[model samples]
Target: MIWADFSDFVSHSRQHFEEGLIRAGYEEVDGGWSGQVEHIAGRTEIIISLPPRFPFVPPKATPANVADVPWSWHRERNGALCLVADDDHDGLWWREAPAFLEHIAAWFESCHGDWKDDRPDLDLDRYFHAANDDRLYIYGDLEAYRGEFVRFGTAPNNAMVMKGRGTRPAKVSKHLRDQFGYVADLGTVDVPPRNWKDLLAHIDASGYLERKIRERLIGLLVLIYQRGDHEGTTFLKVTPTSNGGIDVRRLRSGADTPAARSARSGKDSVELGTRGIAVIGVGAVGSFVADMLIRAGVGRLTLIDDDVVMPGNLIRHLVGPEAVGRPKAEAVKDQLGRQYRLRDDQVEAMSQNALTSDVVFQVIQNHDLVINATADFAVTAFLHAAAQAAGKHVLSAALQNHGDTIRIDVLPPLAGARPLPASASPENHQEPTYYEAGCGSPISPTPPHTVIETAAVTVRHAIGLLLDEPVHPSGEIRQLKHTRNQ
Candidate 1:
């Protein structure tokens, strides 16, 4: 019996397998490739299995055990068989595969005509071009499909076959072996990943696992278990450990884990906690950046803003009437604490101006990134100079009124080299400036049309910057229309 299966993606593994078989003078007989199937041809039988991911990630494939097969022929003792040219990133297997096969037949003929025992070394140029051509096969490239993958395959006649094993089988084909990138050969039966506990929990709880939906569900579960439990929300600290170990303790939190009650209920302390963000403002724009930095998973946050919330700011500021008269830093801290479920120690609040000699500057030195979200031009200039001299990345967002219209600007770090200090050439430096009022109204009688169009654009601009995606400013904005004026 012969078995063959395609990966869940057009990865390097499938490319390696198909290219290997094709180079061996074997032609796919059927409709491309199939998964987890067996075909019997006389006394010979072969089985195939694919791992969860392919290409950027590899799948696990092992041979089935037979009653009487030579062990040496079945499994190599020394020199492991890794997927085709896994060491080289510029190979066909590393690239997408759908279109790569178009010229593969010609490539196979050219290479095999000379009978080279070893596979030919590929030039980086030819490999990248072939790999890039697979884009024609991808449906669409968008954020919705980030970290997503798909798979398809075919078994050719007189070339390869598919077979199913009853638990264990012997003598796996090199084709399957190379496709999965196995060092030697997968063991008798493909061992379900240890993370299968969460995978099974998902399927059993959900009651249905369509082949299409299973991969996505598993990926989601992995993400939840990774971000929610095992690793805290800090981006830099959220790295996976070696040994494929899952920090189960990190994954299970709150009601999900029974041990939540056993953990300390007081302030949660992080190591080297003194070094963290010190936000100088907590206005609408500033609050949004704080949220972005937090969601970007900054480990620690220290807020310093002296302004007290007023009733008018309730419309735009994240705080409200109940927070009126309260210091902005404390208000933001209290609000974010609710959203992120921050422990007492993860956040600290202070009320003050961010002047040069101010304690806030001392706190700012500890942070990795400083954001100047203040509307005051003087404050912005000081922050720009101070942060630049300290070699820190500064991000700021602002809105300018164009008479019934608002244009949002997101100033990222300067390109190429860091900006020189204002002290170096005081004459050459200009103060940071913007012409927007605290009330967020245009300086003149603005047209309602421009107001409607620009307001929508400003919100979208702000969000795109927060999401760290590219955004075009050609009068683009998020729209808000009245539906019969409720």
Candidate 2:
């Protein structure tokens, strides 16, 4: 009856699993099965325990004499063998009992060879036991301050590392008050210390800290050490042992620098880091456009809007219900900052209407490009005139045909380039039905997918203009009638 619960066992019968285990020299145990695997390092007794969910989850394997096995990259702190990377989704091994046992054998073989062919994993924090606390330490560049003491500010659940020991920088102190600092030291080894004894031995041998300094410290200690060719961080908590030795435990830590965030994009992000842009409107389409530009590595942004987030906006807006009553521009800015770890100077929010603001021309002149997503004819005309006077490029995008069509217009900052004719407007097509929301003007029905699709096309052109790529002078218009049913 237990086999009936799992479809996999029905196909490869429970009797087959028993026969496979017996042939592999394994015996049924009280919880699961046990077997001994031979490797170059001798024999290891592996115990595989099937989870309650059976075939839905993979069986967990661990050594019977866990303490006797040496630490390696493929071993977890809880003694379970890490058979695959965290992101691996292949289900071949867990589909049946025989394949699962074979995976365990391969893991032991890899351990025997010392994992020399394994790719480098810069995160060394996983090898050791973490402290009980949940506080996370966020740091920036520390290459210049290696071997020197640095200050940090404490918040509710996290702390920020600041450089130097003098008066705390006004920019950081405003958000987080100064709590404590740590000494940034470079380690000699690329791998993490095996255990508390190994860590204490390294500290004594390196002479990075004196007895008085180590004893005076009361909390977490951060080490900015080298890992192969790159850098890595390690957080440790040191306490005195009964034998006069020190016990060290690793803590959670992360890097928050611009270089760390943009490392995924490689060289493509380098040019965009120096570019700035201003967006007029933070509605469904505009919010997504701003978010995409930030993720693409645009260094600076100015968000301008006069509307506030309403409950109805949540269907397509970038923000959540928590930002319902807040200004659209400020909410979008906060959302982008939390997602990208942007500083205050990186994003500026202006809760003023661009059409009515007296300094709208100043904003246009400050950025490399301006994006208009207000979908208002009057606002579009006003922005085009302002961009012309300021000698800047303006990109306008809108959804038409009840969200089935997307229109994008580009006005280059050239002497002879002019705006597209009025025929380009959706108003020239069949009139769209509008739904009333009780108080304000009637709104057209545009689904979330159409808004996202429009934003993608609009941002593609914006990035092309910023990177000086060739673009059509009149811009592009796309029809999505075939995809409307979805």
lDDT winner: 2
Tell me the alpha-carbon RMSD of every candidate.
Answer: 20.1, 7.5
For model 2, how big is the CA root-mean-square deviation?
7.5
Candidate number achieving the greatest TM-score relative to the actual structure = 2
Total residue pair clashes for candidate 1: 45
- lDDT of the candidates, in the order given: 0.40, 0.73
Q: What does candidate 2's lDDT look like per residue over 83-119, in tens digits? A: 7565654654565567867777787777767666676
- Tens-digit lDDT track of model 1 for 1-486: 223333333444665666754553434433333222121211222232233454545322222333322322112222111233456445434343333332333323433343234333211111111211111111111223222332212233212111211111235555641111000111122111223243334333543322223322221111211211132110000112355332221121112221332233223222223336656677765665565545444467877687888775566666658898898889988988887677898778878887655563566477654555565677767776665566644443334332321333333343443332222222222333443556564333233444334434443443343344426422232223223332
